[model samples]
Target chain A: DTAVSQTPKYLVTQMGNDKSIKCEQNLGHDTMYWYKQDSKKFLKIMFSYNNKELIINETVPNRFSPKSPDKAHLNLHINSLELGDSAVYFCASSQAGGGSTQYFGPGTRLTVL
Target chain B: SQQGEEDPQALSIQEGENATMNCSYKTSINNLQWYRQNSGRGLVHLILIRSNEREKHSGRLRVTLDTSKKSSSLLITASRAADTASYFCATVPTSGGYQKVTFGTGTKLQVIP
Candidate 1:
């Protein structure tokens, strides 16, 4: 079974458009995270949710927002997308504790033209 | 500034050879973890070693940690072509919440068969 899954594997939209990526995990994890990987392969954490509560919010632009409706799902929405937003976004989940192993989704390749 | 930095950004090796990647972090950490990302895929957890531990072994993978130097290394023995992927080291800081981890610049390994 796929432990972590993401929808809309690819997304291409014009500048200023809005898009959303969905993530779900069946591992029964309590913490979910959203990460952005640039063309240089530098991965940065954007947001994290624990038990549907916002736990970590990095220095990301306000145009990007993360929402977790339940412990099993976390979604990312970007507004006024720009060319710089063209990158891969990953969703991850892990148990709520220190030194927990994280499972990641397939990732969404978003292209802002 | 990134919390973790990896050296030898890329490496190419023949199949059956061992590959090693090193990571250095700037701060105190509770534990260090290694992850692998295949092309066009998300990250996969490989192994983790706590600050108090010196080394760990799993399958053909071996990991070593040096808290005094604030560095870590990952060694994959007898690498196969399937092992060609990007390797990343993530550190969980000792100061703050545990769910947040700082990822290093990835090392892309090319294993030729």
Candidate 2:
């Protein structure tokens, strides 16, 4: 069984359009996180939610928003997608503690043209 | 600024050869983890070493953490072609609240069959 899963493995949208990527984890974890990997393979954490509560919010642009409906799901919504938003977004889940292991979903590649 | 920085951005080795990757961080961390990401795939957790722990081993993977130097190293013994993937080091800071993990730029490893 897949522990963590993401929707729309690939997304190609024009600039100024809006898009959303959905993520779900079945590992019964309490903490979920969103990460953006740039072309250089630099992975950066964007947001994190613990037990459906916002916990970590990095220096991401205001256009990007993360919503966690429950402990098992965290979705990312981007408004006014720009070319710079083109990157692979990953969702991960953990047991909600420091030094806990994280299970990652197959990333969603977003291409803003 | 990135909290963790991996050395040797890229490495190529023959199958059966051992591969080593190093990571350096700037802050006090609760633990450091090593993850592998195959091309077009999400990151996979490999190993984790806590600040108080000096070394750990799992299968063919060995991890060592030196908090005094603020550095860590990952060693893969008898690497196979299947091990050709990008390896990253992630750090969980010692700060309070939800400890957000910061990932370093990965080391892309290529194993020649």
lDDT of each: 0.92, 0.93
- The TM-score, computed over Cα atoms with residue i paired to residue i, of candidate 1 is 0.97
Which ten residues in a row are the worst by lDDT in model 1 chain A? A95-104
Best-performing candidate as measured by lDDT: 2
Alpha-carbon deviation at B14 in model 2, angstroms: 0.8
Per-residue lDDT of A33-99 in model 2, one digit per residue for the tens? 9999999999998998989988888899999999999899999999999999999999999997636
Weakest ten-residue segment in model 2 chain B by summed lDDT:
B95-104
Candidate 2, B16-52: lDDT as tens digits: 9999999999999999999999999999999988899
* lDDT tens digits, residue span A1-113, model 1: 89999989999999999999999999999999999999999999999899999888889999999999999999999999999999999999998753578899999999998
TM-score of each: 0.97, 0.98
